[model samples]
Target: MWLPNKNEKKKSIASIANDFIGDGEAIFCDSSTTCMHLVPYLIKKQNLIIITNGLHIATSLSERSDAKIYICGGHIYNSSGSVLGSSASEFISNFRADIAFISCEGISKNGIYMSNDEQAQIKEKIITQARETILLCDSSKVNKESYYKLCGYNNIDTIITDKKPEKNSFLVNTDIELLYPVE
Candidate 1:
């Protein structure tokens, strides 16, 4: 399928962040690069609380107003600047949030998967605790697979992408909601 330029897609997807998130709500944000795009949008909301293992997301939002930032304690990875491990998962599972914005390496009929298992554990744990679980991905990622299956398509409440998905039974028969930027 033909796709938009990478920069445009990133901007479109980043803007949708505010639509899924709300003011005064607490959310769990995954450590994916896509999550960083959301921090700017979230900074504008009032009384927003953010919980994550992403060092970048934590520090960037720290100086912002009307928000609380919580970083999961665990072994911090140098490469991605994300903290992960059993300790991280345990820490994340302790608090409940309003929503979780997670980005994965790929997604297929089997499930949404991630590149790292440790980050996947934290995401899955947050999925259980948060009232809403929203998957942030681009159309290029659809029908692809990753190393760890974080959750099945049915598990998430909605998926916000830069483009709308083609008609498929996995999306048609299930309760999953799909969102995209307006033309």
Candidate 2:
């Protein structure tokens, strides 16, 4: 029951993401609100190549002359400002990214999960094209279950969150590196 305040958790996520990202990296970012917090940090990187399905994320970084933004073309979800479908997936396959940043609705011993099947599929494809996949999750979503399984902990190289999971929680049994805001 370690539910965290939304704004506080978002602040934590932003701090942690800033530390993990570096300059001149090719990145894949999913269309999740949590990932949106990464926009300001990404703008600071030099020669950053970002490929994303999040329209809002692309637009936010669009003004950064230091970065290159590529938005995937596919079915658009007006509510989430996300594009996902076969076309988007195919577009993603053309590039090999240094890292993929994704978010999930829930995390459990079984695997990471998403509420939307299309988003889950898109995340799956992103994972395949990146050398490393990082999941951005808040404490509130831990231990919760969702409708579609995106992948297992094995697929994620690291997880950045607002708080570290409980010792007895399923995450402790996995090898994924867990990061949280420190100052």
In order, the Cα lDDT scores of the candidates are 0.81, 0.86
Regions more than 4 Å wrong, model 1: 1-6, 168-173
Q: Pick the candidate with the highest lDDT.
A: 2
Model 2 per-residue lDDT at 130: 97
Across 83-155, the per-residue lDDT of candidate 1 in tens digits comes to 9999999888788999998888888878888878877888888899899988888878888897788888767
Tally clashes: model 2.
0
What clash pairs does model 1 have? none
For each candidate, give its TM-score against the true structure.
Answer: 0.89, 0.93
**Candidate 2 residue pairs in clash (backbone atoms < 3 Å):** none
Looking at model 1, which ten-residue stretch has the lowest summed lDDT? 1-10
